[model samples]
Target chain A: MNLKRLESILDDLEGFSDPNIRYEQYVTPSYVAARMLHTISLSNHIEGKMIVDLGTGPGILAIGSALLGAHYVVGVDIDSSVFQIALSNLADLDELFVGQPPIDFVESDVTKCVLKPKSFDVAIFNPPFGTKGNSGIDVSFIKAALDLTKVAVYSLHKSSTRSFIVKKGEQLGAKVEVLGQFSYDLPATYARHSKAVKAIDVDLLRFSHR
Target chain B: MKLLTHNMLTSRCLKGVTNGYPLKIVANEVKTENVDYNSEFIARVIPKVDWKVLSSTASDFGVSLPEEPPADIESNEDMLRKVHHALLEIEITQGDLICPETGRKFPIKQGIPNMLCNEDEVK
Candidate 1:
């Protein structure tokens, strides 16, 4: 819709703080977000189609999709902060379009959030890997993600827990595919005690509910 | 480092710790700069954090934080400011996060962390 408004919202969001300072939260970098969105839109022919971003922090992926001409983009996150930011971002975009198709932000957990099943053309996220007292919530998040869209793309670590999500996705009858893997650096404050936690292989997984 | 990595990392690389719950952070070089933050993002992530890991790590980074996080912190600008600064400001520009157990070194270079070890040492 309104590209300028989108830019302004992003600019404003940059000053707040690292959103992921909470828990299991990793804000997808702009490059990763842009790259993932491009891959999903191009591979799935998502232009002019409905798109959703689950766990949509700062609404980057969802906003990026809308900017790329998605018919509609919905971002859902359990955190009110995330939803608020996304709502603000979308509102700005709507202002630009002068009453275009609205971008939606729903505040709900990925597992329990109600979705318009089979209604979304594409869904994207950099999901949490229930490692840090995650309560293993990502399992339900992935299920909800796959259930809500025709095609879903996610970024995840290749930990044992994440591997289960990938395996289960295949069993769910979706045409599951692992697209790409890249290592992302953790922040400096993290204790450099592990075996390099080679775990953070940002996987671009495509799930075709077709 | 991102809390995502903090949540999953263990000090097993250095060796001899039964529970490497909180990896010790000894930052030789630290840089705190402009990292974007959105309150909404933090709120959503609160449930998924490893609080023990975070509070301990924050202290290591020279930040004194709350042991228990308050809910509805979104409207609390003061609290949010602290959260913002602790997470986004304190950057580890160059340093080693030593494993408390194994004493292995994970190098941070140019704001990026290299956790890769040689082939022989992996096991």
Candidate 2:
């Protein structure tokens, strides 16, 4: 499917039914997901490739990978409650493709989950940026992805963390590229937000492990 | 849990469980469903899969895979079909995925494997 049609379909995907504050769960905008997929497709066709979507809330990235012709897609999330919603979303998109790759959802923590080393071609995630203590959780996801994949990682993070991510990528001996920046509209789900939507700048960073 | 997921999972997170890989499958229930076969996909995934674990797990689920994956998997259509059936078509409806090292049991219900562990189990 073309990028435009894919974006529309992804737009219809259900986000958090009930957002979690501690996990900092926020739905990744379909446009951003589409844009990243399009950009990645320029260098990587995605067809017949193994893709893993870390923290796959409702399987948006995972389903998107399947649609892009990834051979096998695994969506891992700590929460199991969202799997049903994700499966339903996949069902809706399954009709569009003749033989989409098998998509699997694993209820596991991204940091602790043991995937074969270099098992996947690409690891994609929109990891939490909030600092748990001294460090942000996005670094952990990047580290895990680097450990798990052979090719590259596509991740979403707050634009402010660009330098930290780049430094971490260098430390891990990977090349980091800022693919694109987009405004993320954080809908006021919590009581603290005075506005209906709080917009913030976020960057999509791609780390190539050669 | 599909064998495809099983092939990548390990229980190494448990304390002192080095090489806690290829979790043993103790399947209480198994189901087979038709999934569209893609030869290219199967061929591509074969190299990534742990063939020994896949073969053993498939046998436990009554889906037979060859003892060894074909050397030239890309051109081996028959082997690709078998791998496809083993990975995508068969699902473990209910079971306990036992850790090889710690012997901890992760439950599978309605085809979803709960790999979460207690705080104490986290290491």
Provide per-model DockQ scores: 0.01, 0.62
Give a tens-digit lDDT track for model 2, residues A1-210.
688987998999988888776677778899999888877777774777888999998888888888887877888888887888888897787677665347877888888856667878899888877643325578888999999998999998888778988998889999999989999787675324578887878898889986
Question: What range of 10 consecutive residues in model 1 chain B has the weakest lDDT sum?
Answer: B1-10
Residue-level lDDT for B88 in candidate 2: 85
Fill in the DockQ of model 1: 0.01
lDDT of 1 by residue, A66-88 (tens): 66656455676655555555556
Residues B8-115 of candidate 1 have per-residue lDDT tens digits of 344443224455444556567776655334566445345545666666677776777678777767677777766656654566656665666667766654433444
**DockQ-based CAPRI category assigned to the predicted complex of candidate 2:** medium
| Model 2, runs deviating above 4 Å | A99-101, A131-135, A189-194
TM-score of chain A of each: 0.77, 0.92
For each candidate in turn, the TM-score is 0.52, 0.93
